[model samples]
Target: MSFPDNTVLQSFPATLNHRNATIFTANRTDSSAQQAIEDLIDARLQLRDRVSAPLKGMENDLFAKSQPLDSLRPKLRVTFGRAKRDGAFDWPVEEVINTLGAQKRGAPVAGLYGFGYRKSALGLIQEFFIFTEMLDGHLNGLTWLKRERNIQNLIHVSFNLLHALHSKDIVHMDFWANNVMIDPQQPTRAKAIDLENCFLTPTDHLTEVLAFQFGFYYRREIFRFVIEHDYDRLVFEELGKYDGIDRRRFDEIYALSKHENISRRARREIFHKGTVVTG
Candidate 1:
């Protein structure tokens, strides 16, 4: 679909609300942003209790915050619940865009709208942007892995996602299958929807593996990739863990993964090396 010249498809309001929560682009009446907000509201209204697993307070809080939907957005796509270890009040959602920039590779993040606090109800809400076209939820975890028999495609897309973040000097502390979103049309490409625990640094590696889920050994190998800057090793090692992947498939995927990483690193090196001229 065509958009207007002044339209801000991946943009949000630059300020917070009176409650100090992040304000969404409710004021942008002419843009597609408003319609996106309406869609989120519609999705929330239609959400059933049985489907919301793990996220306990989802339905009640969504309904409570629904009245002022224009001024609010969900911290999670559909789920609702506080992190047992981390406090919801102090999440760094609003500042992430400024630190990390919007797009990684070709995929744009759902913009961070700010934070929302409502009395004794939903203490603090980390408001991030959402596009309905990308679907309201991410793939269901190992269930998806079982269904997705083409393991090579999953490895390439998932690893490319890691490479994209590491190239930016950003480490996604909580990397899990559920946090990732894959477009139905282009299943090969994946984008991260959750970014609350992301850390930015000039350092090449992240040593400690604190909080993680799904693929315990595989996740550690990803951390190893970040620490060692070994793209080939990551591809081979991760592929080795899955017995279903054949040698031919492994070689092909590994070659693509290696090529992409080398090209990415080369571009980064040149970009950071700056202008150098002989005297």
Candidate 2:
């Protein structure tokens, strides 16, 4: 029931997942490796203070009520602990709820019920977990687009969400299809999740985590599909309307984004920061 004393946890991979805590399962046959992994995980968890004091304080309160072993969820395979400096514990339940409310003006978002953290010998750890209503029959944007043909509504919904974030002085630095959930029940509407990287009028340095080129490339591809497939004018108009940029001007801006002479940083700033480029 307990990990061996010597497990060495692995660092997180660049590949994306909803949770920040990366779990490494112990191998009963290879006790040495499992122990090493567990030890590393323990060490990593104990050294971090990334979350706000209020959140950490709240988590400490929660931890006070439960045993560390009691915090483990078989489903998640994550050993819940105090918020870490790795930004895992930053999305406390209150923040998620507030963000959901803020996002109501744009697209639908999953509901967060509550959160909890755990304490260790090193004190409060930096990892935490949340409870949410399952986004039933939902898939990430990347997978959904590959299978679904009715792309217009999803695209519109994404723009709406982005515009809504912009209106609130928020920019979702991690605005990729993978982060956007497309629910089968709400085919036309997409829900934006993973707001951990979202920032309110974030400075360029703060938003360095965002992969602007990937998102811009995705949008450009979507734009091309709209044009090549001869999607209804209404769709184009709707995109322009929701995005707060003229529909007629999309091609021009997209062109500028792809220009070889333009610096990558400049292109990213133009595309993601909404810098208007006049002819």
Best prediction by lDDT: 2
Q: Which residue segments of model 1 deviate by more than 4 Å?
A: 1-22, 26-89, 92-108, 113-115, 119-143, 204-279
Candidate 1 lDDT tens digits, 1-279: 111211332444443333323333323333343333344434544442212121122321121122222333333321143222222221333123322343433443443332222221454343332222233444533434556754445556665666566556555545555555566556656666555455454333121111111223244334333333443455556444333434553454333332233232222222234211111
| TM-score of each model, in listed order | 0.43, 0.44
Error of 2 at 210 (Å): 13
What are the per-residue Cα lDDT tens digits for candidate 2 across 183-202?
A: 77775566666665454443
Which residue runs of candidate 2 sit more than 4 Å off their true CA positions? Answer: 1-107, 150-153, 167-169, 200-239, 242-279
Which 10 residues in a row give candidate 2 its minimum summed lDDT? Answer: 4-13
Counted clashes in each candidate structure: 3, 16
Give the local distance difference test score of model 1: 0.37
Give candidate 1's TM-score.
0.43
